[model samples]
Target chain A: MKSEYLSEYDNIVRTMQLYIDGCKQGKSELMRPAFHPNASFFGYAGEQLAIGTQFLFDWIDKNGPAPNIEPRIVSVDILDSIAVVRLEVAEWSGKLAGSGVRMSDLFTLLKTPGGWKIIQKAFHWHAAEQRLAA
Target chain B: MPERNTPQKTLESWKQIAAYLDRSERTVRRWEATEGLPVHRHEHERQDTVFAYRHEIEAWSRLRTASPNPSSVDGADTDNLPAPTPIVNKYLVEHDAITRTMHRYIAGARAGDSDLMRSAFHPSATISGYCLGVEYTGSVEHVFQWIDENGPAPNINPRFARIEIIESIAVVHLEVQHWSGKLAGANARASDVFTLLKRNGEWKITHKLFHWHDQ
Candidate 1:
């Protein structure tokens, strides 16, 4: 890969790391560097679409003085100025502990003038019963 | 033979017409019904023998697919078509975002993660597909809720056969190998077609139409 592409890739991975680490540490401010002001999050808690990062931030505020999170970057794909990162997290602590849900996060990032910033975050959740079979 | 651009070159039967178009007769028939593909009947032969003009089929395909130009089509002027290298490169570059969207979709389905699936589509999108030989049509939210309540298929492997983008609109042909909790032991293969739009520099699925193979 070209050096420019590699640099961009590294920057994106680092940006995503900041967001996940922020959530784990309950430092909402850490998320600011990684996410765009207009970034939106979409996920299904049930039938509802969990929109915006504020709710997640609030949840972190309520439960995460510190969260025990094991986050892994599953894959990253980049083309031109856009990149997407697939992430999986196995958490045994915080509010999510004992919930028995397996989650996957897909973050869409753009190479902005300020640097790579996440523009959108989408996620999936699997119940514990289903996880057992898998 | 007829003059260029004129609807001549009378094809006497469906077989000959299908050969000329390089498609099955069934495909052409579906096109005629759904896409308004041109087909003419002999006035004096009592409409028994179907016929079509070669030029008309070319025009119809161009109009339906919204190609960059008709010249890029087969049998058209090869010299007039733009060079393949740069065009293909541009297409692949543009398709990167779409590929990510699809990957998110598959991951979401397999994991029973509503958030990932929601992220793959616009908020207002709707889906129409078959489940267990039954037709299902509903909002994206409804589909999400169904999956949330019922849980996702145990295994979801989606493979893409083609992704065609014309300007801001795209269509993808995908085959999904799926098996869920409710329906176990039955082979569940689904052919999914997704329509996407590029809005605000992002590609998101706007609509989905699909059918299960066994259904």
Candidate 2:
């Protein structure tokens, strides 16, 4: 990677860490900085397609903490003022104890005047058998 | 605004304008709505009618053809097309380059040849997602390895859902069905999101995130 890209990559990762940290603590406030004010979310929560960022924040508050959840940065692709990051999260505790949830998240971010902020998040909830295998 | 040294003939009604442009009234109406076709409306007590100047319509047609995706214009005349401006040309070139790169990736998947796909991706590209309830992560090389082991998927059908470009950055949404591999016997489908970047005037896939639909 070019020297400029290296710095941009680090900055993007730093922003992503905020999201991971928020998930670990189960606090939407901690994750707010990573996302734009009007950021939207799309994903399947079981059979229903969950929409809007508010739903995500509310879900985080309800789910509580998952200290054991492990998040991995799979990839970060940057182009000029836009970027996309793929994240994999495993071992996330569900409402019932011993029930784990695995998630695959794709984030689209823009280099706003303020900084890099996630503008959209699309994710998929892996099946339970996949979580158990992991 | 009307230009000098051009025909000042006024085309009355949508039908006349369509006839002048050699297009259907519906198509001309759509062009007015989406492409800013120059049309003047007369407000009358009974009904309002539209009119267009021949010169203005001709100028609009030339500008439309000079846009990045002129192929989208239905039944466009190929002769005597105006040269696109530098900015528009740049966008058109980049769009074509990105599309070719995507085709290479698809070709590689169909033939199960990692080498064919290697050129489509950056050296540091990564792939991550789940297949059959299994999490796969790490370098893009892992995908090549998996493809090699699984052999060819000549029967897989891929449809490009969307391609959004913002300067040097782009995102592609693709849906594939009848993908042959570990899930060959079963009808497997997947939705893939690929992020691309233009480096040194070349577009390459930098990241891929996918979701395999549950059977």
Candidate 3:
């Protein structure tokens, strides 16, 4: 990668880290800077279609912390002003201990005047049956 | 209420008009054909060279829904209509371009032509996925080769589950059924995820990941 892209790659990773840290700490404020003000969210929470970033923040707050969760950045594809990141999160503890909630998150980020901010987040929560099969 | 100083808003294309009316382009075009929507076409131009005023559309919408028998406005004089101020929405145009690129991929798959499918991808594109419970990760050429070997899937039904665009980058979720490959008579269902990038004014698939479900 070119030096310019290297810097951008670092910046993107830093932004994503904020989100992961927020999940680990269970505080939306930690991840607030990582997202654009008008950022939107779309994904399936069980059979329900979960929309809006507020829903994510509220869930993070309610679910408390997931200190033992493992998140892997599968891939990051960058263009001129936009990028997409695929992340696989596993072992996220839910209400019950060993409830292991795994998820696949696809995030779209834009290099706005304010810097790289996540514009959208689309996710899929892996069901127990699917996880066992995998 | 007093009249406002703002100029009469004109929608430049069928996409914009549909968006303003909160309907699909197909639905709005059907309305123009059957329900006498106030749409004006530019003379000496193609059929798609059309425009409509928001006020006119609003009036037609109200009458079409409220009245038992809505009067036709089809033969209205176009010479009297105000000149259209073109509002070229780049987002809508780009979305159409991306959709066309996806269609090329689908067309290629339906015919089992690797050359046709290659046109929709960037030269540096890569593909990673599982085929018949085996993990395969490599350049997109492997996929093209596999498609050529597997032959055409004329009966496959593909659906665009979701398309998320943010500026120059996009991600598409495609669901396909009856995708016949190396599994003999057992047609397979697959969920494909494509990441696309707009380069040199053209959108191309940069990467693809897929999962073939149990037969």
Candidate 4:
């Protein structure tokens, strides 16, 4: 009998670490298992549509996962195969070397064939003083 | 003799399964074929189709609570996975339910489901943002008003939003960032906890309180 909980917990951490490594390496293959083959990237990527894994891979190739961006887990809840993660992606405007956005990302992920993948992702970022002025 | 006409509420009777999973017949079939969504097994029937037991369906729904939180860098269940004080479990259950509703609401906004967006929260839902030295508070209706005034949900910034639920009660800490058109304005981000009481057997958000991180 499991007193608290087991399994999946380690798998998720491994997956998040994988994502970070993938982002750092700019290797789309690294991200392959973290997202559904049909996974879509929300938010913006210039004037084009940011849908599908190709866009994410390409974005990683171009931008490099926001330099100096670090993730901190605030809390998480897991029940069965569905889980939600709350975290703060702490970073300063100067770190990114451009328009700065500080704060965290709240996300929901589900266990999948390859491993744990993000099904839905939401973020709360701070606007840079310079960009706000512009 | 059981009430046969009451439709067994049994799992995997095509019609029943589709409704239970909130999926279309075609989608359900496809998922069954590929996603390993546990096929139904009707005793003594079927050589071509598969089915699930009612008990298993209920089992899966109950399993959602133990699902792993995959985004944590450490990827463990609260390390302690405290069983005692998770009195918080009630809060957790409610949080999960409402967040799902919120996700559907945001997604529907892309589909032009105005009714969904409007009805997602209680009519009295409210938002408050604090930053620098200023504090702002407004009704949940005002948030929608600003959304309408701006544009669609996707056009808004992905950052500056967090939704947390604790049992039948939940809270959404968020900021509205409209980048274009008239709604292209930024709303300071703050935490707003909503008390979603089980009213008449249905979870309904009654009162919502907002606060600043510093306070």
Candidate 5:
């Protein structure tokens, strides 16, 4: 693979890594550039929609900064301007400690005049009974 | 005219050879479903395992390949076609998020690994449609519930055989003659579109939808 391909892929992996790191460190500025200023974060938890960046920022701060959490990228597949990334995460919080692995993204990354930013986002995760074939 | 023995060209369709060895149709279908009909996939068409000889397949089938090919597509007894393109992939990933989640969940179903499947879902994922000819918009929990209690494994292997992953948009589509060997079995196919989020430095399935040939 060419260095360009590797970088686009790394941008995804590293960008994702940065976003989560921002949340953990309470540095909201860490994730500002990765999203549109109006970018939204959506989640379905118990029939309710968890919305907005600030909603999550507050939640993360209240949740004591989600300690001992480790997020690792399992694999990255690049196709021109689109890519899919699979990841594994572990949280070591009291009683909530658990390991979850998912292949959860189909990103449309634009190599814009400024730089790369996520233009659109969606969601899906694998079932509980699956493994990454090595 | 005497026939020349062009012993080597490269036969892509092992679908025929599997027949000669007296392998069951199920065996052949399984191979076709998984790795693809044992043909060399080119930018255009699949080539034969060897040169297009008259009696090759029949001779290998313990008969005469020359009598006539029974199932050549389009009634033409030649093996050449145009180059392959991304035609099929467009439809496959058109569902986007819904299809992505479906692939992840189906991967879970095939592997008998729950932890592996959970990533393709939200904690609230559910199967809210008809299954076994009944209409039920249930939770992703229910889908996971069934796979846990029941083994959709070897018992249903003969009919519910394989999965094909197209190289675009994370499409994982399948045909199941009997899903997990249910009493009133179904030949169901489904897909969804999905998106990812960077959660704590990791990617997670954030949205998805589904569609199935429900009974």
Candidate 6:
């Protein structure tokens, strides 16, 4: 029984890696397998609230495909079919150069017949100086 | 011989069930459809008439009040194909805990209970906002201490503007109306957004950002 759960956990991690790789490559198709199709994103773009996956897709379209940004999965917590992941990104360039914006993304995913798929994301942006000392 | 009426042992009509539950008929009907409320329709007789056993409703109520934390439930229940009812019920139970934490935050702010306020936040949590048109950024502990030093606000009411929960993470938007603290006559309204994470089977605010409006 424990082995079964462990295998499921590995599958979830692999699905998440696909999502990160997709964003890095600016290939929506790569990320397609990692999302539930009705997934959404929420965060602040300056003082305004940015909503929906379109914002994320637009940003990826404008800047990836041979990307300069680096992403790392910081943590993952799973309970049954639902899971939460924390991802951090750095090594920004181009229009984002010297903006000093540090991004941390929290994602909610569920295990589906197709494997694990992200259903929602909430982002936290901070200044380089204030990057959570923890 | 068994008694026919059964002396308050069963509810035979929707009206009676609704009244027994102290809810509107519409609400009870919605609960039956959505939350799997134990309501049985007469199939042997006419299928149109609805009836609910008193013992069944009582047992269901006991279960509802018995478990407020989803983590306490047995894991074997979730091992099979995920059912919508159980999943939704688990989320609802977890959501209640989040709201309860928010309410504790409000109570802490009103009474300047730094300890209670601190319990709602992670030790490293930071708060940032403009106070009297000046930018102030500091740790959550600092804010709690500040509340203690300055005394309670005469009136500080926070209404939930929005709450989103995704697995173990949550985002809460609070619209606050505060009067009589540092700014007595001005009476301010603020929009506060809190980012929270469930860690070690507990929820804590990790960050807070707000915009203040003088009114």
Tell me, by DockQ, which candidate is best.
5
Worst 10 residues of 4 chain B by lDDT: B77-86
In terms of lDDT, which candidate is strongest?
2
Order by TM-score, highest first = 1, 6, 3, 2, 4, 5
Residue-level lDDT tens digits of model 3 in A1-134: 56998999989999999999998888889999998776666654654556678999998888888898899998786654556788889888754223577777887676666677786676767763365578
lDDT of 3 at B84: 37
Clashing pairs in 6: none
Model 6 interface CAPRI class: incorrect
Model 6 chain A weakest lDDT span, ten residues long: A92-101
| Listed models, DockQ each | 0.02, 0.03, 0.03, 0.02, 0.07, 0.04
Query: Taking the tens digit of each residue's C-alpha lDDT, what string does model 5 give over A65-98?
Result: 4445565665565443333454444542322112
Tens-digit lDDT track of model 4 for B1-215: 22223456555466667666655565554333322344544223112234566565544445344434343333232322213222245555554455544443443333233444554555544443333334334455655565566554334222325555432223354332322334333332233333343323234443333332332
Off by over 4 Å in 3: A96-98, A128-134, B1-170, B173-215
Q: Estimate, for each residue in B1-215, the C-alpha lDDT of model 6 and write its tens digit.
A: 11323468889887888777666676565445323456665533212367889887665554443333343233332212112233347776677567656765665665555654666776656665555566555567667876677566536656787677755568777877653465333356666667676666566776665566656
Show model 2 residue runs off by greater than 4 Å. A1-134, B1-88
**Please, what are the lDDT tens digits per residue for candidate 2 over residues B59-131?**
6665554434342345553223355334456676676567667766776776677766787887767666556
- Fnat: each model in turn: 0.00, 0.00, 0.00, 0.00, 0.13, 0.03
Of all native A–B interface contacts, model 6 reproduces a fraction of 0.03
Error of 4 at B202 (Å): 25
lDDT of 2 by residue, A22-60 (tens): 888888899999987756566556545566789898888
CAPRI grade, predicted model 3: incorrect
Residue runs of model 6 more than 4 Å from their true location after superposition: A1-134, B1-88, B183-186
Task: Give the candidates in order of lDDT, highest first.
Answer: 2, 3, 6, 1, 4, 5
Off by over 4 Å in 4: A1-6, A44-53, A65-67, A92-103, A125-130, B1-162, B165-215
lDDT of 3 by residue, B36-127 (tens): 56676553321226688888876665444332224333343211223334336677557756766777677667667776577788776766
Candidate 2 chain A: 10-residue stretch with minimal lDDT:
A94-103
Greater-DockQ candidate between 2 and 6: 6
Chain B, per-candidate TM-score? 0.54, 0.57, 0.59, 0.39, 0.35, 0.57
lDDT of 5 by residue, B84-127 (tens): 23334443333333333444455456444454367655553333
Summed backbone clashes in each candidate are: 6, 0, 0, 31, 52, 0
User: What is the Cα-based lDDT of residue B208 in candidate 3?
Assistant: 71
